[model samples]
Target: MLDLTSMKINDNNDNNDNGWLELALSSNKDNVKNLIEIKDRLILAYKNYENIITEYTTNPIKSTFLQERELLKSFYEKAPKNLNRNLLEQRNEHLFEQCPFCGRPCKPSILDHFLPKDLWPEFCIFPNNLVSQCDKCSTKKWSHYYSDIDNSVKFIHPKFFNLLQYIGIQIEINFPSPESIKQPDFIITFTLPRGININDKKRLSLHIKYLDIKTHIREYITENYLYWLRVSEQKRYYVPDSLNQRIKESYTGGNNNRWDVALYLAMINNDFIINHFDSIEIKKEIQDHSDIKLEILTEE
Candidate 1:
């Protein structure tokens, strides 16, 4: 949900420096030569990444080494930790604490093969082919690059696409009734800006759907909205500005695509919420910071 277009990882370890690969294949010397020979070919396929999305059929990056797929994948797994550690570390410098793919407030701990290593073993160690992602997003994604039914790309490539510039997340809150304000229904949605083409929009929508982004967003909003409401209620004077500032703080240190921040902004902007701000119920449990407030009393 954030733009990682500026992220440059493993710049020092390209085709020229196959030392990492060499080390990985040191034990098994037989395939080392074969892999090293195909280094240029593998890098070419990586450089042609953009075309792969559009033309999966004709792209030359398919799984060709059928018999050696496991061996190639093992090279990626067995590579010495220090060799490609930069790929993990540098991704944090640009993305900060946000996962580039989902904008979650966690460092992307796993290196997910943008093109699954199982399917395309040639690009197993290709730095450009790996994406830093959170556990849930990586597990959920699980080698699904495109839809089997339609043959379209399933999600936005964080490194390739400028996500925040083109797509924005919007929240629509629905109150049960004007008089009652126990909790509102938090609806999460995507808004494509003017410049994006229909095809890109379709892809983005599919990306959101496949990743279950809307559900994650709704859960985030629902869990945090009441806490924010409590904070706003605590500020007796200059409530609007204080509330807005509070909401902005949630996303200020990280990516702007935070769903909780969006939900709070939507609440503050809504006329009904602003007008009836005082009346909105802040549960006693929320105010006390613990849901279970009842103390067990023993009868004498």
Candidate 2:
């Protein structure tokens, strides 16, 4: 199972141009309209911030610009809370990571409609629908939402999803693969659906399409499959004691649990041990042993 050691708060890089809040405040509409206005404002402010960062690299900034930076920072410090504090904080932190889709290493200044907000305004503010992305990937996948929303909801949220519920990680001794050695790779067949009925399926599909979970899976495979395979071969003859100890040390060092998953998958797929270990059985065992549970509401 994937272990979440601790969640760390990222550095505050909030730029204080409260144009979005201003838009929300100025909106004459009711609650939903106000929410939409606020959403738009957030998007615009992010875009503006992105532009500022972009220009910083190429255009020399005047002393006045540096002064404005301090002003913006102060404004953000005192900005009123509008949404859930935890969620807002997480969103701000996510902005620091590169876009998962395109590998662009910058926080996007605009909200991407994984499923266009137009189609499912209900999820416009859902944290799962919001991911920090660069401009190029945002434009490329602009209208490309998921085809299966129901399936999408079943998928894990990178920020909030529990990896242990539907899937588990472990290093199997034997599996069939091109690499002669055993290693780990993530494996799972079950999908999630808390209770989405037929109608809900249609709606869920919208969310799924928006997030591009399928694309994520493919990307995961392409990126880690071979790397894990190589690891398996190198460590094949190594005793489990040493391997487990190494893993324990790495865990203590705060390596991501996804690394373990990669090792599990590689071990399973390698041809050296297919008959010895049942991949599915081992997977279920891992899930059962894990502490994480997937549920609709956030854990309190």
Candidate 3:
């Protein structure tokens, strides 16, 4: 996950300057002037929204312009591409190679509404309300912001918490019995930094659970193990050193919480894997019964 600390609604270009509000207002000719009255209020609400959502007990924040909800949501839904083009570009300028939501080494391709547009449509076009995320994560995290049971905010706001920098994830690989080396099972867990607040800790845990982050990491490792193993063998580099180089390269730029980086770090720390690198044989069964010397094409 990435910390989009620099991205916020107020910091972005005013939507009014781009005539987005005007374009959206054009359709509702009857209520145009009425809706225009709340334009500044909406902007102010978007700016101060994050501050009010400080704790689990805090009530869900909605537009104070309750009577204008339909007009605002309708305008947002029917907004033309040109209006969004600039805003989306501005948001993407700071996007990292990794998705902000999952940190899966893919640049974010879609803008996810932090609060579902169905429920809180006033902020539908708000820059702070839009989270840049990969398609898979966006699909998985679709419209999920708060817990249904407790009605608490679930996903940590990237712009506010900067939680990715505060929390670290660890990988634990568990090999099968000595008789079976077919596949190694693994677990992904979080390592919280000292002095993190209780609310943030809960938010982190809820984010991971809500997004199914651990399961996804585990599946990725299991599915891609042979591919990485084959690549390492072909390159003829020391496995530990290769892993170290990878971790160093990708784990730079203040993002040390990536799952792939965590995997490499875990392998580097495991004495069994490190010491047995040279002798670690690619068993035939594990290699789909193909000879190790033959070219093996594995999906990334």
| TM-score attained by model 3 | 0.75
Q: Model 2, residue 68: displacement in angstroms?
A: 26
Give one clash count per candidate, in the order shown: 0, 37, 0
Report the C-alpha displacement of residue 93, candidate 2, in angstroms: 3.0
Each candidate's lDDT (Cα)? 0.65, 0.39, 0.67
Provide TM-scores for the models.
0.72, 0.34, 0.75
Candidate 2, residues 162-258: lDDT per residue as tens digits?
3322222233333246453334343432233355465444433343345453355445544554554344344433333344564565545332334
Residue 250 miss distance in model 3 (angstroms): 2.8
lDDT of 2 at 6: 24
Alpha-carbon shift of residue 170 in model 2 (angstroms): 12
TM-score of 1: 0.72
Ranking by lDDT: 3, 1, 2
**Model 3 lowest lDDT segment of ten:** 276-285
Q: State model 1's lDDT.
A: 0.65
lDDT of 3 by residue, 88-113 (tens): 67557644787777667767778677
Candidate number of the best TM-score: 3
lDDT of 3 at 175: 78
Kindly state the number of residue pairs that clash in model 3: 0
lDDT of 2 at 285: 61
